[model samples]
Target: MTEPRTETVTLNGRPFFLRHWGNERLPKLLLLHGFPEFGGAWADLAPLLAHRFHCIAPDQRGYGQSWAPEAVSDYATPKLVSDMAALIGDAPFAVLGHDWGAAVAYGLAISRPDLVSRLIIMNGVHPVPFQRALAAGGAQAEASQYIHYLRAEGSEQKLARDGFAKLLAMFSANMDTGWLSGATRDAYVAAWSGPGRLRGMVNWYRASPLVVPKAGGSIKMPDLPLEKLQVRCPHLLIWGADDRALLPEATAGLEEFAADLTRVEIPGTDHWLHHQKPQEVARAILDWFPDR
Candidate 1:
């Protein structure tokens, strides 16, 4: 496989790192990664799509070599979405996001519809439905208990201790980690080892407005304006059915918000499906936008 070209672009007055695959002349595809991972998270999937699209993966605000702000408010969803907006400028492009990256993708699509031609989410959820599930204190809330843990003060230090054993455990819990060994594992460790990176990454949880209630407990749902949360572009959701962290409930009612939504389930995989089954994930993405 060919290596991705690395570059830096200033966004929000801070230098942000990016990894590019394929030529810039092709249709642009922005790939957003999730927690405990950076733009390099697309290493397995972007190359497969490079044949037809210029895949650009950013390390996001707090991951990899990108700007890592110390304030928790800096990781807010709107701020995160704006960073991507700055990167893309005036042209609209296709966007794909996994895990926490999906939150920014959804925000971009909703807040700046003209910036996203198409939206793709892998093992991620829309905020409205996800927040509902989380507030209900059901399966999804139980699964998302880690969010609170991550938001706790000094939690990043704890996760980084003992060679990141706690972080690794949290990442691999009830998921397939066979793909996370050798060099891949070392790379993740290195990213986490960056000064203040872990705190910056966890701040995303602290800054989130979603409320995750305790199991068997329910909280009043926030009044989310549906009009402001609509995904106007074509949307594709590729789910890893076996994911334990994000239950199906998290994605329920997604169609109500997405104008044109298509869902495809890839069984026998979990949260790391992109890593464990990149070909299938790529195929689903390519198939969704055949005419592009």
Candidate 2:
């Protein structure tokens, strides 16, 4: 694989950091990183896919070197989805997302399917099922309790202090993080330390309206038509079965939103499945979408 070029693009006058690999002439492949992660999280997967497509991963909204506005409104779903739409442009590109990035991808696919050629989700939930899981309180609500903490005032300082101790603790709480070396730790520390970056990232939680019910509490879903939110495109969901944060249950009833939904469950991994099994993850993607 060729060495990736680091570049920046202006979206709605806000600058976004990007890492590009492969030939730009090839069909585009856009990758989005999840919470507590930056575009560089695709370091391993991008290179593998670059040979087949022009792979570019952007530091979305409030992460890494992207524009990190302090207002919660800036991180709202519409704004976040627009950021992706701007990056995708007029051409249809395959979009891959994980965690919070997945939420953004789902929004884009549902609201503006023209920009998305296909959708690949890894441990990311669709709105209806995810909101259902959050409202139907149980394991998912218990797992997502941290969302409340992130929404709390002053949570930014707690996560940033001691070199992002609390943020790193969140990663450790769920899955195996034995792969994080001193150097990797240093890079994450740098990304999280960006000016107003921590506050901007946390605002994603603050701006979201999805309510996670408390223990023994049951919540209700909105009375909207599934077709309104259904992903009207080829969709592939690659799940990390052992994910403690976004449990597998969130995927229940997902077929109702994706008519052509395809699922591949890779056992024994958690939320950070790409880092743990990049090759297998890439292979799953290749099997589903092929080289196009």
Candidate 3:
């Protein structure tokens, strides 16, 4: 298939870089990428679903050529949600997010259910269960240790050193590096190498309030009503069971928050399942979407 078109549209007074596929007249699917990644993260998976859905993946707020606000507070949840809301406007579309993007997707569903028709998350977490697991602190707490490091000052420079060696290593967990061929690696380098982009991306971790407990400490769970956080839309989860970062416990009890939830697990795949098994990810997502 030919490469998707690229464009930048102003949203919330910021230029948002978007890579789009298929006919613009088709139904829309907003694909959100996580930290250390840009819109092109979906390069492999988006094409598989392009025929049925208009795949529109953005560089998000702090990645790639998109606007990079230096302040960590600027990347707060409310601001992130508003950026997406502005993008959707009155249009009805399904939302798909991976990693940090998944957080924003959940935030959108919770804050403005009317703006989202369906929610699809890959290796993403919900507030309640994730908080519970992080608070409980054991295996997951250990796996999430990197979160604290990323949140530290000057961490972005560490990730950017040696051509983003540490940042790229994040994706190498539990998956072959073959997916990140020379071309793919160069694209990511360019995205992360953007001035102020690394700071903006890392600010996501800094801006988040999720308390991942230290090795042995436990955090009390916050009281939040399901009514306020419920994902009323049909939601589908495509998980890579081998994910080392966000453990299975993170998504456990997710059903309580989503009214209609479909869980699909692909064994032998990790956090980069979309990259390792793009075809399978596409098939599962297409099957879950309305009208197939």
The model with the greatest TM-score is 1
How does candidate 1 score on lDDT?
0.92
Candidate 1 lDDT for residue 35: 87
TM-score per candidate: 0.98, 0.96, 0.97
Give the Cα-based TM-score of candidate 1 against the true structure.
0.98
Q: Is candidate 1 or candidate 3 better by TM-score?
A: 1
RMSD of each: 0.9, 1.4, 1.2
lDDT for predicted candidate 3 compared with the true structure: 0.89
lDDT of 3 by residue, 182-206 (tens): 8888898889888899999999999
Which stretches of candidate 3 lie above 4 Å from their native place?
none
How much is the lDDT of residue 193 in candidate 2? 88
> Which portions of model 2 miss their true places by more than 4 Å?
290-292
Q: Which model, 1 or 2, shows the larger TM-score?
A: 1
Model 2 Cα lDDT, one tens digit per residue, 1-292:
3457998989889999999988999888889898888988887688888778899899989999999998899889999999989888898899999999999999999998999989999999998898888887898888898888889999999987777788899978958888676777778888988899889889989999788776667678656566689899999999889888988789999998999899998877888888888889988988887544
Distance (Å) between predicted and true CA of 271, model 1? 0.6
